[model samples]
Target: MKKSTLALISLLIVLCLLFVWAQNKILNYRTWFRVEEKILMISDRPEITKIAAMGFDGLVADLLWIRGIQYFGGNFSTLDKPEKRSGMMNLLRNLVGLDPHFLAAYQFGGFIINESIKDHEQAIDFLLDGADNNPLTEYPSAWRLPFDAGFIAFYQLKDHDVAKELFLQSIYGKKFAAVSVENAEGVKDDDSPEWLIDGDPFSSTRFDTSDGVFSLNLHDERQVGRVTVQQDSKRPKSYQLSYAADASMAAWQTLESVTNPGFYFHDFEPALKAHAFRFDQFKIQAEEDEEFSIAEVKIFGPRNPATPSYVERMAYEMDRAAGRFKAALDQYMRYYDEAVKKGDQVSADLSLQKLFDIYTNKCIEILQETAELYLQEKGSLPTAQMFELIQEGYLSRIIQQKITEEPGFVEDVAPVLMPTGNVWEILTTWDQKDPHLLITYTNDLGEEDWYITSRTRLIAEQKGVAEKLQQFVNKYKEEKGTLPENLSDLLNEPWFGATRIYEDPMGGEFFINRETGQVEARNPKY
Candidate 1:
């Protein structure tokens, strides 16, 4: 080989080594600078950073996200400082602003804001922004933003109304079609019934009297399975719903006679096929001075063929939360009972209060679910009287009576009122003006304690009743030398009354399980 060629090759190798050394020095300098500064070295303003990216927003966002994660980890303990927290949040906002599709950044940033920075309002706002930017249709995971926002609003911020809206958004996500009202029966001046079908839940239509009626013309016969009614403060106390095949109003089939109808959504079973529907016999006033007002009305066609995965997930989460609360309630009740048996007055008192709180939570959860169901079935909100009947386990009986009272009622095929298996006597008072439910509980000291319901609580009274029944059953078995054939056999005993065993708050018979000697109900309400 020629000497000139060999020398050139050696020079090229030397130059490559020099470049590698320079790159390493530059990386070391960057690390040293970051450590010394101990601050984010990026523009806080999202717009400024986006402009600086110059069409490389996505790449810039990725780099910022990595930097955010590192910064958050490093300054996590010091996030209590306002400046540090604000800096972290600014970085997250900039990252998402640059790449709105950055799902992980939004979720993680929400966590940082809520858990680390302890800024619940900002966390909710950030998450809702994420939900807005990432449409669920385009990105299925976007539902998590609203779901998490609802969780924070409910559990952390204690804002149930906001939480409910967020949860509904997460579940439904604007899937329903708007219904139009072709005609109205009772139009009073400016308050027209067209507002009822205007697709705005907040706008209301007022009627002059209780005898007003609203009619709908579907143009073409369609099968509708659900009817949602949103009412203002002046709501109907009772109403009749019917459907007909034609506009002639002859041979109208009665759907239901709803009393104390709460506002929201109502669902019908066995979808009705008709071109015309009528909402009449509206007994709107409990007092002579009151007026009737309805916000919106919706008639839904058949549901979608497939349920969204997010909806399924929301249901699962609701059930899981209920289960967790139920378990906690059961444990606390056990503690209360043990304390009582041991004659620990102080402990018993504490446990009793705790039991009230826990049960109130559970009742709130059940009550919310019940209200939703009632709105679907009865097309109204539950009143104090309705809850009183439910607590006395007389709701089903009253419903049965109403059905039988109707003309041409059949005896054999009359629908049976099934036991809900729920033994919790939720003695609640609902006010239409207020969105909250007020629950009254009398403690052992004979003082009435009032509680505002929120989410989940325990059913201590139900468990107490079951426990008492089980004790009686055990006594009967011990005396008779075998399990009784039926719970009715215990009724013959002096202590066992027929009313105690037969009358259930949830409208079911309580029976003794012969095999386990355990007290069980005929049907499970939940």
Candidate 2:
């Protein structure tokens, strides 16, 4: 009887779950159907499953509009027409309007439409529509679509200040309460003289922007010179450490004696503020002692990508958010003015506040959200670029893995710049013969050099070097009576003394084997 009761209870539970699932399925199907209907209203007006078949060229209209894909010429030679790309933008916007949370579509659509329309102003319609749709995730991808579109405004569109402002604004979405506490003064030894917090916090002895580029303060008294700036306080992601020599000059020199990322000290009598260097960059440190004299060590500034100060990056992000908001607001205000003039009072007033509130809330939300993201993504603070890449599906582990795969090669080939368009341009080159000349760009800075395949080709090009060696061997035999066993003996000869058998540029050395000449260099693997 007990078994029977248990079986009956199990059946009831199963039936109940099935009923609930069925109800949920019906509700979801109904909701999706409505959305589907809305989508059809925009594109497939007749709501038919099948459209006229397209052959050879897929969607003739799309072919004409797209940029890279050919539309005409009956062949693949011509670039894709821009008109098809515009149609794609419209299609993507319609797709996004139906389901706003389709994040990849925004990226894909942005890539094509941004280029197709050529009018960046109109191209944003699809992406903005996508940005407004929320699919509901902890990190709402909808928030990111506008950013991808905004790049069109900045880069492809060539409205630089606008692009920059948008990029800066994109880094922010959540708010971060930038918390900071003033440094506590260390207790001095009784034997030492008392000291006061001297000069402008940002003056010669100590330069504290307080926003975390760097803090430089000098302590002085007697012959003992010790300048203690903030050490390990934090480092910006892409900053260089240096100090100014004076106010009038606009240059800063690298602190050579310093070993760590954020501290410096020197043997000068009393480390005072450098009153000379004022600007940011300086030449490499030479052996000159006075040039490296100690005064103050500045942590990298806000502009420095390496700046790790939470307070500073947060502030920079906020300032950028505010700037973008102001501009957007101004545009909104203009629209509002026109609406009011046209007697559309409801829209004029509502639109005005809506724009302001969006910008204001955005400013607050992003500032707060950044601090946490920085700690989560970087463990400390993030650089401007790091902040941008991390939020966009990029993982730090992948970046580290890529960096590690090349061994020290990543550092050796770290590019100063890469090409970008609406998307970005990547040049993939393969060189099996001459590696030295196989560099991506032929013209290079004086410092940049090739180490791998290019080096091997350079070795291959060295010709007369071997011939020169053979000639020397013959001459040695004639002069020294018999061939010398080693090159040292031949060095005494006039020709040997004056002419070299090795190529310095190619790093090739010639050796004689059985009266024959041989040229060799270190292989690429080495």
TM-score of each: 0.44, 0.24
Model 2, 275-319: lDDT tens digits are 321112212222432111112332211121221223222222332
Residues 243-303 of candidate 1: C-alpha lDDT, one tens digit per residue: 8887565667887887543353444445667776777776665655666777777676543
Error of 1 at 76 (Å): 1.9
Q: Best-fitting candidate, measured by lDDT?
A: 1
TM-score of model 1 relative to the true fold?
Answer: 0.44
Candidate 1 has its poorest 10 consecutive residues by lDDT at 409-418
Count of clashing residue pairs in every prediction: 18, 47
Question: Whole-model lDDT for model 1 versus the true structure?
Answer: 0.63
